[model samples]
Target: MPHINLLPWRELQRKQSQNKFVTILLLVVLVSFLSMYMLSTYYGNLRDGQNIKNSFLTTEIGHLDARIHEIRELDKKKESLQQRMRLIEDLQSSRNLGTQIMDEVAKIVPGGVYLTKLERRGSAIHVIGRSESNNRLSTMLRQVQNSYLLEKPTMQGIIAGEKSSRLLSDFNMEFYVKPFDKIGEAKQ
Candidate 1:
């Protein structure tokens, strides 16, 4: 064999191998960085879409809540109006109660009895009257009992008096006025 120097060729070969290795490492790093960027962008887009959907749902819920509140307010107002209407109807129906009571009292009065004063408090009527005899007062009480407008006649007091030189009895009595609706039902 000829005496050949192979060190230079061996050194060149080692350098070339190192260059190739460095280039492959750089390519791998670049590929990994690109993949990571793509994955991050995809996740960001998904998060943005979820946020938009959530915002829309929140807005819709707010509108529905407002409508529910309005409906509740309207219901309350309707109830209040209905209550007022009922009160007005009651007042209108009971307007003739005084006349009915007076008519019943006039019909029950006998010839020898005279009403002095009449007082009403709540559902009770206070009747002060003068009668010629106790029998006349008894008859008046019986008439009051049979009347549709009055009931529960109670004698509070009785005193002897002189009217036109004849003895008379002054009396105080209380009677309860029947409710208008009950009176109508009883008549029917």
Candidate 2:
């Protein structure tokens, strides 16, 4: 039989097995690195997608906020317009009230009573005049009480002067002038 070199053969087999183990370890490390890289890339893409959605939502919310502001401004303008309209209607309705009050005053005046000065403050009327006699003044007061456009005619003050040829008796009287039915009643 030929003599076998077992030492060299065993050494060669040990070197081959060590090389195989190193290669398998390097392959496992490479596979782990690749998987980590893929996972990182996927998470980065997902974060980027989420950021984009957030940006879009922010833009849409800005538009909605602007619309809400515009609507509030329009509502304020509408309220102002409504107030102006109400003021205009009130003015229109009371347009003829002054003339009517004057007409009523003329109708209530008795004969022999002449007004020298007339002043109006709100609904009150101040009359400074001369009457032919005290009886005439009483008659004028009675007429004012019975008239349609005068109420609560409280005689505030009365002054009498010496009798004169041109004027019968000097007097001063203050009374109130009432307004029309609906418009005046609502005020009270």
Candidate 3:
């Protein structure tokens, strides 16, 4: 209404607004940098914690690996010891087999049958003997067949030898010896 000059007032108001905007921008820039630094610190702490856990897991894995190797060694030793024990057991079981077989043969021989040779080859016994007559030789074979320790009695040969006081027949036989446990079962 009045012819008033308002240019200086508008210029001053514009300068004040510009000052306020600069102040607000400076505060915003400082707050942004501070938030970024805080976020970076938090992430770095999280990364350090994860690395520590990973290192602990790796150490535990190494210990477990060592224990596994020890267990494998123990298993091998156990297997070796078991094999030795089995061999000893086998030797122990067969220790008196020869004596037992000889005793049984001596007991089962009938009268007047003279044994010339008694040898064992594997599981079989080879016998060479002289008898007064064929009947006595057959009796010996029957005794051998009925005995508990012998099986599959087989006569290989019989030759009429020269008279030695009486008629003598040379004979050879072969038979398999039964296992001790099997003989015991037969006795029962």
User: All candidates' lDDT scores?
Assistant: 0.90, 0.80, 0.88
Return whichever of 1 and 2 wins on TM-score: 1
Candidate 3 ranges with C-alpha deviation above 4 Å: 99-120, 123-188
RMSD of 3: 6.1
Which of candidates 1 and 2 is the stronger one according to lDDT? Answer: 1
Q: Model 2, 1-188: lDDT tens per residue?
A: 47876999999999999999999999999999999999999999999999999999999999999999999999999999999987887788668778977887788778888889888899888888878787878888888777666766655555666545545767777777665454456455
Model 2: lowest-lDDT 10 consecutive positions: 179-188
Best by TM-score: 1
Q: Which ten residues in a row have the lowest lDDT in candidate 3?
A: 160-169
Instruction: Put the candidates in lDDT order, highest first.
Output: 1, 3, 2
Query: Which model is ahead, 1 or 3, in terms of lDDT?
Result: 1
Per-candidate TM-score against the hidden true structure: 0.55, 0.50, 0.53
- In model 3, the clashing pairs are none
lDDT by residue (45-94, candidate 3, tens digit) is 99999999999999999999999999999999999999998778767867
Off by over 4 Å in 2: 1-28, 99-117, 121-124, 129-156, 160-188
Residue 142 in candidate 3, Cα distance off native in Å: 15
RMSD in order of candidates? 6.1, 7.0, 6.1
